[model samples]
Target: MPETNTARLVHRLATLRERLQPEMDRREFLRTLVTGGYALGMAQLLGVEDFLAADDGEVPIVTARVRENPDDPFSLVEQTRDVPAEWYAAVQNAFELNERLARIAYTGYLGSAVVPGDYASGTASISIGVSNEGQSAREMIRDVSEGISINTETIIEIEEIEDGFEYAEPRYVESVDDGRVPSGIACETPSSLATLSPALYHPDEEEAFFVTAEHAFKDEPDPVGHPLALPLDRVERLELGTVVYAHPGEDFVAVEPNGEMRPVSRIAAPSPVRVRGQYTRLGLADLVARGEELEKVGALTGHTTGRIQGVDAVTCFTDEFCRRGQIRWGGEMDLTDGDSGSVSYHSDPDGRDDDVLVAGFNNARTWWPGQSYVWGVSAYKLTAEHGYHF
Candidate 1:
């Protein structure tokens, strides 16, 4: 009779799993159960602590320890962190589960982001954004009891973006003003208008270029020939120069100067905002821990500040593939059409008041109903993916 009850309990668990994950097949679901609750994914299974010391229970993960490249994406630093064994195992299980489901891409799987919490708390949640067709909210709640932590977070619905930046009156960049060609001003190409970034140094090329969002272009990106111009007073346009390089995926276009104007390491604020350096993933996490906000100056939006929402966010909603090392911050209203190339920056803690460090580039964002935060690629990601720095 006791054996019958035990068997029944297992059957009930299997049935509950089916109810929760309607998208996963029975065989696949059973494999996931075996993978998560048993060997290959279990860290502290009952009576298994004999295998290793209590202090050794933490898992040394490479991915969690972001790449160690301060300059380029090619150099990988082999540093590891000691994460709680159980938490690491759970994260691994979640990754496997997400991977299996993503392979199927069920009817309404919008996207997913892994939100890592305090390591001591052994808590981490995967926020998945999906449409109504896949699984209902009630079923998902039940799955939580089984240690399947995937939150169906819905953000951004309307894709409407207002027109590009247009000045009520005419304005132009003056060559006479030193540090005038700084960030936060409008930079126009043949196709679109984008916010100008501070002088980005290409160590390998040994040159600096005026950078902006590549998507600001109407059609395809012109890497070498396209010129970037700034609107000004006497002359209709101040030519920055032809595009030296264009990274559509990273969403930055590096323009070489053709005229007398030179790019400076300053932001277009009433007071000087100097570019000191950039933040690592750890640095961004520290900001998140302290509940700090970053400020940005967009060509259209002008200036606005908002709290950082998530760090080391992997966004798969944009293109065919996924974009890792992204920072989600600010309100959606803080950014607009021409604001794509602007940067989010925090004041340097050790440097002077005017010195600031780059956080990330303001590109795409959430425009849905329930959610209201801006999202962008992080500077660390650019250094990890490509060797460019501001």
Candidate 2:
């Protein structure tokens, strides 16, 4: 029997190697080996019997109980408001204009980021807008420096230059210590033209921010509990804790409250497809079915039905020991590096619109063969625990 088991194990290993060969690189192979060893060790200690028992196929059946509504035969009335033709036409025109402007702005912004700058001798090729046409390259660099100072002091460090222009090569900066000016800065500029833009001078200014959807805390000294905040605008910041369960190979980084810095293994991608209004309609069917079932059984006596209005990814961190898996949203949207701690909201009852409910925070992306998964923290759970209405 032992000989037979050994033969089976060898066959399995050979099959795994054969299957993995097509896409496996050195790093991937090493990662697989490590993960496989860990799994085997865990199985041996925990006993595979319980693990196998946990896989029993059991489908839950939901039963509905009837309930009588006190307010029977509630009148269903259509609320109507008349709009003047001129007002309607004006609104339509405004919408069209706004849409055109938005499209132009988005295209120009992304185009500028991807475009390469012209490299000239004796001067670095900097991005010049209509506003900065007359400014000298040196002056432009100064302005960029000032802007960085205003937002984050001395985050950009100028290190030694290599074969390429400053805009084309990575530039390193000294570590930010007490916001004081150190001897020098160090960083490598990407080949992209957007790197030269004053807008992208700050580390957080670039759209490509990393994100992580692991369990994190607001106030904690441990690396796993360290707070990571993303500046939304000039005045607002979205904060989250660190996730320890993230893939160690990812090289995640976070900023601390005391302005200290640490490296993490998992970081979330910043950009996410913002789902709002009609876009959230995709989940409406499933939500409505569940809601209706609850309503029929009087489970929704005080609850009102609301459609999902918006969805965005937020950052979370795992425990210090990295026992739990980090949670995140995985959707069709392209997420960037700096979007780790964004807040997603549903509808507010006291707000202008009452037809929508903010669902949950989108957390991470899970890539599959042909599709991706969007993971999110359920709003229902948050509301239940925090006594907040959504």
Best candidate according to TM-score: 1
What is the C-alpha local distance difference test score of each model?
A: 0.66, 0.25
Q: How many residue pairs clash in each candidate?
A: 4, 56
Which ranges in model 1 have alpha carbons more than 4 Å from their true place? 1-107, 114-124, 133-149, 155-180, 221-223, 233-235, 316-321
**lDDT score at residue 75, model 2, on the 0-100 scale:** 18
Q: List TM-scores for all candidates, in order.
A: 0.67, 0.23
Worst 10 residues of 2 by lDDT: 192-201
Off by over 4 Å in 2: 1-330, 334-336, 348-350, 353-356, 383-390
168 in model 1: Cα distance from truth in Å?
A: 7.1
